[model samples]
Target: MSKVDADTQSKWDEQLDYKKLPDWKDCASILNKRCQYLEARDSKQIRSEQCVKTFNKNSSTKPTIVNPHRPQTSLAANQRSCILCRDLNHSITNCKKFLELSVMDRFWKTKKLGLCLNCLVKGHSVSRCPSSYKCKTCEQAHHSLLHRTQPADTNSGIDTPSDTSGQSTSAATHSAMEKEQVPEAQVILATALLLIKDSSEGFQLGRVLLDSGSQVNFINEKFANSLGLRKHRKNVDIVGIGVTETKIKYQTQSTIRSRYSNFEISLEFLVAPSITGYQPEASLNVSSWNLPSNLELADENFNQPSQIDLLLGAEAFFDLLESGQIKLGEGLPSLQQTALGWIVSGRYKSKYNTTKKASCVANTLEVGLDKYFEKFFEFEEIQGLRSIWSEEQNECEKHFIDTIKMLPSGRLMVQLPFKKHPSCLGGSYDIAFRRFLSLERRLSKNASIKSQYSDFLKEYERLGHMSLVPNPNLDEDHYYLLHQYVLRPDSVSTKLRVVFDASCCTSSQISLNGILMVGPTIQDELLIILLRFRLYRYALTADIVKMYRQFLVNPSDRKLQFILWRENEPTPIQTYQLNTLSSVFG
Candidate 1:
């Protein structure tokens, strides 16, 4: 919402019929009421006789519907296609093609920087994974330092200050063999021997890993074996991706952030999700592992430490990120316990898409409440309502009816079928389920409360009394106004009062937040003014009817930058648009 839009909304609200208006100050308070249904009426009259409360309307015993202008819609275009994914004109943020695509465009680029967090998988950067160099320092919390000292023996090449065990000069020469330690970085990167300590369930295995990107503890066969850990049970689900090895090198002594001598290193191993083709969920038990002796021998004979229950590789990393348990260690806690790196940053992926199809209709029938059914099902039955769909989806009609009949959650899922879901994405089951649930709006439509919210605002102006009404279903007008403008964080609805006393003029400035309000007017007339004050600001007063109800964040994240209105608030403001922000009450 813009300042002009807000101001315009105020003007029209002032011009509405104040004599018949209701008393509610805002829409939220009105909708918050718990009323379920109102008695039916046959005609359009101010006085309603069938309602629970017999209200007066001039002077007549009449029966009439409370709101008759519910179906009013303005003429406008809806839904823009996604630009990157190209599947839709709308941005990937609002595209429902695949959540993975959304994540790729919205999160990976800006978050990953140059790291390859998704090296084990497809479509991602590497920076998302843990750094391969945090092990050598002393302050490392878990592992304790222990160095082996050899007794003095010139023959064995064990030059020590004390007496040495007697041995042949040849044996001494063999003993003199120096164990050149491979740098921890080289070891992690060069080797692919992720441990599989417990493999009793032949072919089924689990392991431990050290993924700094992870939050909570998880277990995977590859991660377990990376630390060279042994387990009691076999074939147990490791619960995470395989632990991979990558090397690190430290050559400079002065390059330390906290404090420590920097040694040269290289990396190779990996910690990754163990899912077969990204299938099979691992049952993980998160328990802290006891640390091994922390030995930081300047000599190249030691290994680094790693520790984590299920060190989520690139794939599983974001699942548990919000929980916030994955951490980076300061020093050598133990091998496989601590991750070494210049810094550790988490990478997240998001895929959210919603495509509503009205031209695309489904075959489902709606029936009125039954005697035994009314006691059980208060709303219409799924079988009787008319459906404009094909034979395959007609089963959905029965499914919808049976759903509400069989399960309690079914009624809550009131599905109003339409050609709502677009056929695409190899057409997975998840899409089918979404299409099934899209049919519940009929109840609101029949109840005549679809426009209950907006109508109540208009009524408040007419009757001067408080009333509440239910919102419309998906195929209805662009309902996202509730979330985008009304409820979205930091939206205009937050800072400005929907209704004011007209005395205190505390003005607030608002932009579209990148959210385009779609499908405002199918005709030229203002269907009840959304904003009573202004018409157009920035010449943006158009709306699209087709909108993405739920918007997933974008992928690529390359051009990702959150425009901040002020300092101290570091959160990036990535706005997801439904279609276009041009739609407004003109």
Candidate 2:
């Protein structure tokens, strides 16, 4: 194990070479021949008789040698309290109370003391005792087998404790029921890596928490839905410490395989909400749930998802525990067995640390497409909508520029404007432009992306979303600007969309025309909307197609939304101005 040990072993090996020695039988023969040669002694010594006398003397042995100076017993050794009589200065065997008892009574007393019948010692029974003494009754090594006494009927005349309150049996039952209804521990949660077996996917890696006290196993709704699991609706009440009168409204059947002990089991799980009331004490705090190091889980949506999923529960836990399929270690309070494959609980030493608030730039998705759909669609309906949007493009961009051109702009028009624009938004144009160029190059080779972008541009051009301006018509009267493009793969439409930043900088000065725009908020304040939704049994939800592009700007404000555009890499660049509010206007 260590360099020192290895060197020591090598040095020890150099002292002997067994391979160079004589064969076993040959060596034995040589030894025998030497013994025969020494068999004869000098005639005056009477060698044969002398040899017999020497052998007989050595054959008979005495008790093993011990220190001659040490006493047989010490004051400290004798002072320990006797395990049997609870007395000092002597052990259980030599107790005066034990000696005074009858033989049969002593046997029962020894049994009560849980001592080794053979050695008359505590800590071990006769079967495992090292004593060589045989049973006094049967002359067998096991003292328990030879000693038999009829069991006493101690409860024959014993009366059960009666309630002093004179309550009826039903009332007593109610009191007992009340005690049983409440439990001490909320849930014993064990997080382990598991192998889940699916009909289509044989064994996939999963992180699960086994709840030994629960009546049924639970799977996270989000995780289950991701796996495309089929569900059956059921309203099952869940009663626990600090839990509300709540119910699990769904159930699903699935098979989970644990390779920890090479075991697999199929069962139906009540699809409970994995995210319940957050209790700092009830959750495991770890860097990530993935087994070993979690670098592999970087691409996944959850580095540490719900701590409770696949609760083994009372129904399954006891069976596995008894069969030796699940082994628990007390030192680290870890569980190891087959459930997901050989898995041990991860290190959960720290308290739950609340995540920090993200910076402004990281909050780009605050008013994103994902957020808009979540506000309107129900759980299952969102899935269907996403599937459709992924393959289809909207047609509402056809009239944006046309409508903007028709709007009258005169000296009489009132301007609602801000004095200062947000300077932080100005420096990102070059980076966004480079990203757009990279996306365009990727789209050139990808048919799906190319077709999706083509359909998007077709609708935008047909709707007059932008109007081209000749190079000669460019004037100092308007501030020339450019909008960057963004590729949102997570969205339903994985196409490149232009990002219009009206706050774009021109030579470190804010654009006066850009400052003259005011946008109307379409989404309602969320708190009030949520309160109203909860009050209605039936409510209508609608999403306007091409939501932002549907709103048109005045012809006077269109020039402030100008951008440089080229149809192809070799084509002459042209100036174009957007006529509708794009995604960034939010």
Best by TM-score: 2
lDDT digits (tens) for residues 1-586 of candidate 1: 1223454456446545645543334432333331111111222121232233434455466633321111111111013233345543433222233222222222343243332222111222232222222112222211111111212222332221111243332332232233211112111210011212221211112222334433333343334443333243322222222343222111111010111222212122222232121111111111222222343211121122222223234443232123223332432121221222111222211111111111100112234555445534332212222223334345555655564322343313223222322111121223222322332233234343334333433443344222222321223222112111122347432231122111111112212222221211123334235333334343445653223211222211101111111111253322222221112321
C-alpha displacement of 555 in model 2, angstroms?
1.7
Candidate 2's displacement at residue 435, Å, is 7.0
TM per candidate: 0.15, 0.27
Q: Which stretches of candidate 2 lie over 4 Å from their true place?
A: 1-439, 442-447, 472-497, 509-524
**Index of the highest-lDDT prediction:** 2
**Alpha-carbon runs more than 4 Å astray in model 1:** 1-161, 164-440, 443-455, 459-512, 515-586
- Candidate 1 weakest ten by summed lDDT: 250-259
Candidate 1 Cα deviation (angstroms), residue 41: 86
